[model samples]
Target chain A: MGELLLMKGNEAIGEAAIRAGCQAYFAYPITPQNELGEYLARRMPEESRVFLQAESEVAAINMVYGAAGAGARAMTSSSSPGISLKQEGISYIAAAELPCVIVNMVRGGPGLGSIQPAQSDYFQATKGGGHGDYRLIVFGPSTIQELVDLTGLAFELADKYRNPVMILGDGALGQMMEPVEFPAMDEVTLPLKPWATTGMKGRPQNVINSLHLDPEDLDRHNAHLQEKYRAIARQEVRYELENQDADYFLVAYGTTARVARNAMHKAQGEGHRVGLIRPVTLWPFPDAAFAKVLDRARAFLTVEMSAGQMVEDVRLAVNGRAPVHFYGRTGGVIPSQQEIYEALIKIIQGGEKA
Target chain B: MTILVGAFGSGKTEIALNLALRMAAEGNVSLVDLDVVTPYFRSRDQKEALARHGVRVITPEPRVAQADLPSIPSGMEKVLGSEEGKVIIDVGGDTMGARVLGSLRRLLPRRHSLLFVVNPFRPFTATVEKTVTELRRIEDTVHLRVTGLIANSNLGPRTTWETLLTGHEKVLAAGRQLKLPVIFGTYPCFLNGNGVRSNLDLPLMPLQLFMFPP
Candidate 1:
């Protein structure tokens, strides 16, 4: 029974960051997500918190790196191409094991694509857009409420693993309004970063850097990062399963998950046994959610706002146990519920190749 | 003609859409989607539903409708010129959104009502000062004074009678300071008869729009 308020997904992220005690927020303006920065711009000053609109996305992420390394809860947000600009900085932060939250309100893109919502950044997020021997924990929430909840959780997990965490959203979720109950500010407790590069006062000096020029040193760092990722994969896999015992399962995440759930209900109304497996955390991929219904799964159909992105992960998770199919609308177009339902019907009829 | 403009997420599109539906009963109505600041949740997305209600939906060209460009649709002058019907312009949120109205100022009907829709729950309009400031900014950007205030404040699905009442009080205070009339407060249609419809002192409009994707 926290105070509930109507909020756009972008604005919710800003409030969540502030409530999470994010000491610094840096970002450049981009459509679909501009409201987020705008929200923070006004609120941060009121809170006496650091909110800087950096000159570019690259500068913004690097600023986040500085703030995070100094032991402040830091974050930045951007759409697709801007996110691409932040890749190298993200990689540096990942290697340095800095705790920070990055929000990607994804827009359609190979370049400066349309400002319309799209989940085409699947590979860019979960698979490491930046050059790396590292993985960032990425959460794709379907609703503004979930986006708020995950924004709080993202800061916690980022600190828990001392790793960068990303909230992967899109223009639809960013721009749409929904009722959200944010966590009470007093309930938030930030973890202390002993490894932070805070100036030492007679304590051991600390230095934070990403470069490991020595091959052996880099190998050891990579192994440690891998171990942390394994632990995350073990404990951080999050998803929602509905009608798990149904014949056909729809695998989707973010806004596409909502559309798929509607299609699932539509198919159910027609006496078709369709289910949904919505991955909240895209990187971990929620393989166990697939396992929950694999026994009853006739097949798994992956839906996305891109041509086919998360479908590859769904295929990997199903691992040939069930035929994994994909249906998507790319270039900023949202796949309608009817389109998804029709795709499911085709798959059920064995008319479409898996 | 009545035009709705306000802070982002202050329920402009919702109120505008609902207002258009209500006005359609009286005569022909046209809901113009003037939002070019954001990429989703514009009123034009409900063109099919509004059309069914006999309210004509005006938006950018069909091909560029999905594109987030500042280009205004061509037939607005004809629609705005018509005195046989009502036109409700669902302007985008904030001063940035209000900029689109600048180019259309010449086409605006002389008797048009510019209403500043306010939801005090939104961060930008959370305070009386902030709400008045944002409304004035919109006025400056569009070069049109807001004639009245529409207190359509709610926390979406989680809106409670308490939420609506408190938001209404803020909007009322803002209206008093601006010397503008508080036209009415809006409650979601689902909350109709749950007490807010009859209990609130101000005239209340029932909103049936949630703008969800199918």
Candidate 2:
């Protein structure tokens, strides 16, 4: 909300979590994401911070589950595989309906893959990584500012929706330096967490488990979460970009969206009407933004670091009203300006009115 | 057999492709293009050429090879476990490129070698310490060990012995710090020896991938 300072995307998430009144952070170090843990490790202790580098990704997420069950703004983070390890704990956090933040600075892979910046984790984050029919509000921040601001917003929404929120990052943003303004200390007085485990001094034995034995009881729990998700779909949606006037929309998310922004300007410079639509929140996707574009554009290109994971969502948004094109650079490879330009050129030539 | 690493314009593709050809000539070897970090010029780009030489090239199908899919080929462990003579994996540049292999490290054989190809003219090329750190980071992510160093310094088609020597000296120093052995410096050439005319320490590796890219 103020002047920005130069910062990495991962560090921005770390600072934003603190400002959002997050009481604790538990994390495990991995490439492209070690900086995030390092940032929190440095800052959390200065203000009597509650930060711990749990032995593994599983342990770190479980710790967040513990903290959030106590009704605290808690967080944990890892890259792709580490996030995979965090699946079980996340499901519990989601089921318990606690407010918590999860930061995933994604790298290439389904397994112990490369440490390059990749958006391959889209489905895992948006569709829910854990088991038993659950969903988390996943936010895709394309810049250092969003990385910071998104964390604060994530805490707010997790409480508002009674769900888990994740700031999905990649190595490029995690490692890259940029200008960002740190939030003022006074502005970060977090709302009281009624579910927090503050020593159980004033209440009965406080429990934070996700075990519901009775079929009817679990069914009610599932139904309540479904209603909450429906509410979130209607209420919490965010997107950004400056190409509403253009005939073609370039849709991208996370760091790939930053590349798309550059591609948009480049296309404009080359006498093409290319605009970009960047979804800030992956889950509760900015469907309305694309819905507006469906009537205006001939086709929408979903640019990502992986193939067409979000393309399906674009199709739903357009609902076959406008064609959806998929253009992506996979693994940790960031597509160059030329590559994106080529995709635009193809779309212009192929999707044009003959 | 060998993996190449360097910045853009560095002759990694050439060296890796040529090494695969040589290894394949010796036996039924496969050259897998792990160059998921670079979208074009991949060692697997010359799959037809490898096919011509009785070498198998594995490129993931277009669907799974999407922009955001993890490029680790499923069941890669089985393939590496069956390596008879050589299997060359041409990795892409820096930590970004090397990391693709890191995820598949658990699948890599312990006897396999990882080559950190160096070009002295590239940015951040002044020190071996930088090389060591990058290799360490790559090793950490993939959990694989770096076995050797490749001093592959060349200025496009006009490369020479002098440039190769300079690149070699820098790499040797860096290798010393990294505690890695110099596998070899590459020599790119065409008919009449008109390409990469370089003479350096260790065995000279003739590269063939410079000319092939999609």
Candidate 3:
């Protein structure tokens, strides 16, 4: 068994990335996730791996693209605004179909918002933060341990689909501390990247490019990308359902899901029928979760730390089979368990008016 | 006055918060949140809860309370200078974080006990040598001598008696080298009244207060 240790979410992500055979790491330091860079800055050199604090977020992301294109397991991390600056490079990385990991420890943001935690980047992470029809496999972990586990898995998934994978966490997850046991370092087995642009020896040159000037070629490439995305959606949907027999459901992800679960238990204690659906994989959206509760769901409440970004996806998933309601706290304020339980009470009492 | 300082994620904020709450039972108490490193997970986040216990929390102005800039709250000197209450100051983590203390060194009360919290589970403070090195670095940065050691070795929810016992030994050895007393080992309050006890001849503090994400 691996040794169990207490770690902050940011530090755990750094340890996981190193264990997953990440050869090159580049990043611009942003708080909430600053410790990740600090941890890597000290550990990467000790492991004889690469860790570079790039000049800017844009520069860091492009460095990841360059490193990943050259067949290295590459990664970069940033908070919300910094992540916004890397959109063009992320788009290119997705279009080029290179494997890389990007971590967005989202903070309050429409601009240079507050440094507190928020889930306002749901649209950016799942719907594609950059241009084009490409999608990144996004994991929304609620705990520090989950942050560690998902980070290692993000690397493997990124390579499997030959596309980018993002660990979409907010500052709460990044700053919080929890106990976690990491898989043994020897257990990490990396998939070979045969198409990587390593110098050709006895084989043909593996030329990697995102630009297809010919519209027909671009169309075909996009179709190929779409097929890969469809395969991922089918095979990689992950979620957790609690209190399935309850008549009302609360759908949430990340730390917000933790709050929903607390409220769910409180309502259950009061003889109210309440359940929780926590989507672990944000991109796949866990649409199947609704199938398990739709028959009895009085109303579906989507809770987030945003102005209801993920709620839109919840509404689409519900397809009007039941009323989809949203409860949220934006600008880095997290909704309390009492507030959520109250929301559930109103919905149960008002019969959809609430 | 009690000043808690340590490496980042070494449980300084949680320990400081709980200590202040515990001290509130004795008399007038004021908890000053002087952590300017990160905006989240500090004692200031629990201002409301602390106030409910009659503990005054001093933090940055309301306008920039959540800002990441290093702006210390005004009237800190007054709070430090006050003689009516026991002041518990929760400083930020690491030598870099302790840099904020440089500006407050002149205002620190001569009677204050600056305690260095050490969690053997954290990276920099994992060994006796590293613990001493890290503690010295913070002391050097702040220009204040740490008078005591707080052996707060834990792995959050994963803490076991074995983990705590073994970590206590490392911190104890570091204490011996530093010529400082290991004040007490802190444990999670959730584990209180569970028949768990430390066999070592060391005091133990049950920490019930924490700044959970809101």
- Best-matching candidate per TM-score: 3
* Quality of candidate 1 docking, DockQ: 0.58
Output the worst ten-in-a-row residue range by lDDT, candidate 1 chain A. Answer: A1-10
True contacts kept of each: 0.70, 0.00, 0.72
Candidate ordering by lDDT (highest first)? 1, 3, 2
**lDDT score of model 2?**
0.74
Can you give the TM-score per candidate against the true fold?
A: 0.91, 0.62, 0.93
Return the candidate ranking by TM-score, descending.
Answer: 3, 1, 2
Model 2, span B1-20: residue lDDT tens: 55555543355667776776
Candidate 1 lDDT over A1-354, as tens digits, reads 376677888999999998889989997998879989989998899999999999999999999999999999999999999999999999999999999999999998879888888999999899999997789999999998899989999999999999999999998889888877877777777787889888998789899999899999999999999999999999999999998779999998999998899999999999999989999999988989987888768998999999888999999889999899989898888899999999999999999889
- TM-score, second chain, candidate 2: 0.81
* Clash tally, candidates in order: 0, 29, 0
Query: After superposition, which runs of candidate 3 have C-alpha atoms over 4 Å from their true positions?
Result: B21-30, B48-56, B76-86, B106-112, B160-162, B193-196
Interface RMSD of each: 2.1, 12.6, 1.8
Give lDDT: candidate 2, residue A282: 91
RMSD of 2: 11.0
Query: What is the CA-based DockQ of model 3?
Result: 0.63
